[model samples]
Target: MFNWKRSSVIISASVFLLTACGGGGSSSSDTNNNPTPDAELTAQQQALTDIANAVIPVLQNSNNQALSLANAIDAYCDEVAISSANVASTLATAQSTWQAAMTAWQQAEVMNFGPSFDGGNNSIRERIYSWPAKSSCFVDGALVDYDDDTAGFDINSQTPRRIGLDALEYLLYSNDLDHTCSTDSSTTSPTNGAWNIRTDADRSLARCEYAKIVANDVAAQITALLDDWQGAGDNYFQQLSTAGSTSSRYSSATEALNEISDALFYLDTEVKDMKIAEPAGISADCASTSCPETVESTYANQSLANIKANLQGFLAVLNNGMDDLLEDAGQGNIASTMTTDINAAIANIDNFGTTLVASVTGINEADCTNSTSDNRLEEACALHADVKKVTDVLKTDFVTALTLAIPQSAEGDND
Candidate 1:
């Protein structure tokens, strides 16, 4: 499982934008219907409520988008089975919807708690998109098993390595029927005699069928996640919003706040280090000075978009509720600085006209070291620096100001 560190929080500062009520008769400005609560709640309450209201809908959108992707896969599979001329267009539509679902999902990536982290394994979250745990060979084997209707071959029982968005990416985007496995004894090898003998049309049809199975599972996971948030029995929204209450899961409002802040570190470890530094050849993970192969969504070339979506999720938490908390703690200047720094990071990504993989490759390492502005490598490095600015404070003054602890997973690493 990927290190699920980053978390999202939203507490709209709009809560402070209430209509005035003075000793005078009602002015026309009194038209604002919803006023501030008569009894003031702590910042944690407001933040949790706002996050539940804002992010649950994003999760729902992802689920809806997954349904569309599944439908497209079904149509494409049918067309391929009959060798229809519309195969090309149908395949394009399936890829497009998959991209849409991914964008929404990336935006919700910061909400790394509650149902998504059920059983502390991130089972539901990984089922939707298991990155860093990706395995093309396993997906290839599972495809053969699913196509052959091999005994005990069930999509539900398969691990994250063999299904979800990453698996679907391999199926839909890869034209190579050749299996990625190295051994002849592997499931997709000649000895197995299942995958290698298939014609191009048969391979295409089989891949589509397997992709549809994964898509349905992804969609079902999304539904279960949303239900976990809003359902009457296991409602996380109520538990978070009513922190410290008799029936609430959290014993104190600060405890809930700390959980939300822990998630903000996603920018530090995942986006800054894994997404940018390693691919840009700045991290030890890359064998060379630059490794374009390390970039995410390589098949679809959507890595840049994924980073942008991550920043969007981070900003949703920072701007929505954390800003007000900062003001309440007399650290409003830090809030302003964090927002400005995060926006600068987003602006850096926005300037790139190409995918992250393209930006990371074909660069003179010397020019990047000198901070050349015209090349892709320099821009990618700048993005890492920009995000690091927010995270530097996140691990230091931000936590001090909010009285929140850095998550145990995030401790003891200079990078």
Candidate 2:
């Protein structure tokens, strides 16, 4: 989720204006027909504009991938309805499509501003791919409801927990028909006990049907999100590139640049803490040392894949124009250093050589420490440390150099 508050006081516009003028921005002249060829968008302005450009294709590709997933799910459900012998094969195709969609959306995760953050309480992104706040229990209950009252229940009207990629994962991956909720939970009680009475094939069919509905809903939401960014709705790309103009939502180009920088912080908390730390047992959330169940895409076992996609998104923003901005500000070393660290983290993740769950399991049982001789655990911990190196600069010097504020979620975080 996004933090409404910014930790540091935003730098005044006057200072930013001075910084921009001193930097390598183009200045129009009546006397000279040709301005200096070196003159161009300031690093800050360029960063802002670059993201606006990048987001369009990111959203478009994500929407296309989602549509593919929906089509695949439709075929899978069709097979299920007829008890086709090719049910498993069709289901595999759907799962593969889901993974592709997930990869595309994961890249879009870093481009989390404008339509993705504005009205409806981030419902658009949530509808497409809710995670870290999802509930299998709610999905289970919704499954029963969708199965029992097919005509009455609408997946489009469901909450994020009940209908998203996470729910689809449960439907497509988990073979278990048992409710995830406890007996005390309404989902597991007599009112919804019909879930358990069904045969395995019946449960599979119901889950597939539910998955098809959820996939369609996800595809619709992705289209809506894409339209919001495109000219069809807000034309956020223009608003972002033309920031500081009356038409743009941003009061200044600096504010627009800050928005993109703030989006990058998602790598710190979500990528570093929630995705890696909690699952690896280093973060406070995992008191037992390792909680593999909390890993993103637990059912699909795409945790490592998700992290890799997150890095790709992170680099998408950092490489866009932030590095040039740093260089113009004489902070090029910061850019080089953090880029190296980010690449190191990626290398560690790539070299881990196995699933995240398997790596966590390899940790020393006695101490729950990542220092074990097990190369997998060491490599996982190395990845965490590598990421922290990049984020450490993000929270301090990067924000200081750019005059951007630290997100409230990272305000007091020392690690």
Candidate 3:
């Protein structure tokens, strides 16, 4: 069911560069006086064809590790039935990555497009286009759900972020449609860049818009699964109080909780991998190879490394936030009764959130362009932390609030 969307993730990446509603963008990187260029969307389609050809061979090839990942996803799906609470957690992961990527891309895309300029995504695209190796954690889908006025997906819908990622994929891999400027021999050409800095800023703004949706709509979809976990937890306790007797019901609840954790991991992985990987895995820091003057020590000493590590530690906190998931699902043991795994996980993440905000708040924006590898890394790290803040809310803080409203079940059932 998700194949169509997944396949398209790398295909639709071209259109995001365009401005709709029949308006032309200036900031034209081209020197041409022409008001409009030939429709180059076709060139974008061709780019997708090229990426498909390149990636498909690998998909069909004989490889152990690559094949193993496919097998694992299959096994995970079978355990949770395609429609249970497990799907909630499954969507959660994708939702988080999508939220982060959109923020990053938009932060990069947020510039205004003026007339007389092609104003393509030159500033950000060029830097990332030739990059090799993708960091799966950085992949993100750009589609907006629920809160978005652009595309309003139903609360129960599970289209996945593949389509959104596809849009970005096309942009990254597609061949250039306007190399006319490159061939021109003018030494003082203003349109020599692939895309403009304004466009990059727009990309980042669009991302922020998408993050708002994940925070609201995506969270709603996961509520039911969380409800199931809490219900099952309560039921397990009630039964034990009546008698130390054990039953198969608790095991079923255990399975449901496990499924929830696994599903979240899967969806998040899907969104995170597809986009982040495309730009060649993101680094800790690099500011156009120009390390800042103040950063005189080790490469890792740059604020970017600290930012990257903290952001990574924050992601670690989210993954680790669910460590207590299975604990409450198990058979009634003494340790189980005394602990609220979900609560503890939430607390840990909340604590980390505070630290991230502190590290990010004080850094100067000028440090973003230093000569050291750490400068760029630091910029990405700080930006990453911003995304992480939103993620913490969607994945942890929001979940914590639900415990207050959801009535813990006194009896457990799979439904």
Best candidate according to TM-score: 1
Which 10 consecutive positions of candidate 1 have the poorest summed lDDT?
17-26
Candidate 3 C-alpha error for residue 291, in Å: 26
TM-score of 1: 0.86
Candidate 3 or 2, higher TM-score: 2
Error of 3 at 258 (Å): 10
Per-residue alpha-carbon lDDT of model 1 for 89-125, expressed as tens digits? 9999999988888887887777776668665544788
Better of 2 and 3 by lDDT: 2
Q: Write the per-residue lDDT of candidate 2 for residues 223-246, one digit (tens) a residue.
A: 888777764445776677667654
lDDT of 1 at 285: 88
* Candidate order (TM-score): 1, 2, 3
Write model 3 residue lDDT over 1-415, tens digit each, in one string. Answer: 0111122323331112111111111121122322132212222222222222222212122122112322333333342343455534543343334333333322121111111012233211222211122221122222222223345444223233312222233222223322112322321223222222224333333333343333333233223212322234543223211121243332322232222223233112222222211111222233333223222111112222222322332222222222122122221221122122322323343444333223333444455333122223343343433333333343443334212111122112111
Report how far residue 71 has shifted in candidate 3, in Å: 37
List the global CA lDDT of all models.
0.73, 0.71, 0.27
Off by over 4 Å in 3: 1-151, 161-198, 231-415
